[model samples]
Target: MSTEENSGALPLPQDDPVVSAGLDIAMRWGAALGGPEKLKIAFEALEPQLKREHQLRLKQLDMQREATARAEENAREAAERMVRLAQQKRQHALRMTGLWLGAGVSFAMLVAGVYVARDMWWLSLFLWGPSLLAMAKLYTLRRSDPGDMQAVTLGMRSAANAAQQAPPPPVP
Candidate 1:
């Protein structure tokens, strides 16, 4: 056999189901064979190199796992930050809307009061009717909105817990 065929196998790509399954089978075979004693002295000279390579591969996998975890944590934090930023923007806009609405309604009520005082009831209706209606609608929407941080955080926590609790697929 060519030396290339005798060389160690390539490090399997992380998270690859096929490679993982192949590795599982290989480990089972090794166990069934009752270890390298079966191969005996013919493979003895290469044992040190094999052990070194296995250790190196395990170290590499450890690094990959930690990196994957950090990447997931970063992604989760970024998503939460984005959600908070969006909520801040919505709150700011809502505050501004309320501020302007208050000012508009107060001025309209003042004008309507003046008109009522002058006995111009029809003009008073035109000034304050829509203002009151819009104010009522804004309050209603604010009450119904589900954009609070507590709600969003609860949803994210539940989803994360669900993912963590779920079992991996059968390896058969």
Candidate 2:
């Protein structure tokens, strides 16, 4: 390595701050340009553009918020409609079940009336029909209505048939 390369040396500025400031004044006086006025006009033009951009951003946010609210409202309405449809279906099923039960009860009563009339005419007329009518009225009560009376009646008939078929207990 050379000794000149190891020497601690630095370049110095050709002029001081006073000289630099004087040169700046002389150059500006020679140019005679409206520098600060042009800068002010540029800043004033940018202010309106920035304000417009900010307003547009706020409008976009508002529109998005409104769309979200509308979507939420639609979802809520759909849910309510689903609940209503389900309730309607349940009510229809209950009504159909009641109609079927009434029909079955009437059929059983008619068969019983025919059978009882052969042996006991007055008893069938005064007691059996009235008892059936009373039962029909009682069954019409909503709170007392069995949900699936057809299944229950079928179960009872099966039980009776099973009992008839079963052997009697040995004399114990």
Candidate 3:
């Protein structure tokens, strides 16, 4: 047979004994078994196995896609949680700052009242009463809430009350 007929369409390496031997055996078998018809039957027999492999590969790809989607969803949830936590922290900070400012203003008013009492006693009384009442109301409102801030407000109110009851310092 011609080299082209022996090797079919592809060129066989004459230098490789193993390849040449395998090809020779295949060629002989093809001839013995009716060649093209036997090859077609062999390919048909292998089609199911090839299809199973393709299906398995598709399933693996689907699983990987689901895993990637889950990971992305988890990341999104985590980011949203972090944003909520940050917003809560900012809100707490603003609340605390407001509480501090309120307390400071009340205390300043009380101090001003005490200093002014040295001369204008009635006007000082007017300032002191309102400041004390505001402090008391603030403390009461905060005390209803359960936190360290509540305790701090209670302490501040008690100190203010104590200062209000104490005798004025002797005039210099």
In every candidate, how many clashes are there?
A: 0, 0, 0
Local distance difference test, candidate 2: 0.65
Candidate 1: residue pairs that collide: none
How do the residues 1-172 of candidate 3 rate in per-residue lDDT, one tens digit apiece? Answer: 7747754577757999998898789778778878778978987999999999999999999999999999999999999999999999998887787688767767887888889877656546656664456554565445333444455556567656766777776788
Candidate 3: count the clashes. Answer: 0
RMSD of each: 27.9, 13.5, 10.0
Q: Which lDDT tens digits does candidate 1 get at residues 1-172?
A: 6323565976557599997798678656656767556545436767998999999999999999999999999999999999999999999998888767766666766666576644443344434454444444455444423334454455446545654665654566
lDDT by residue (tens digit), candidate 2, 99-129: 6786678668778768866554543453344
Off by over 4 Å in 2: 1-40, 126-128, 140-172
The regions of model 1 sitting more than 4 angstroms off are 1-42, 119-172
**What is the Å distance of residue 95 in model 1 from its true position?**
1.5
- Local distance difference test values of all predictions, in order: 0.64, 0.65, 0.74
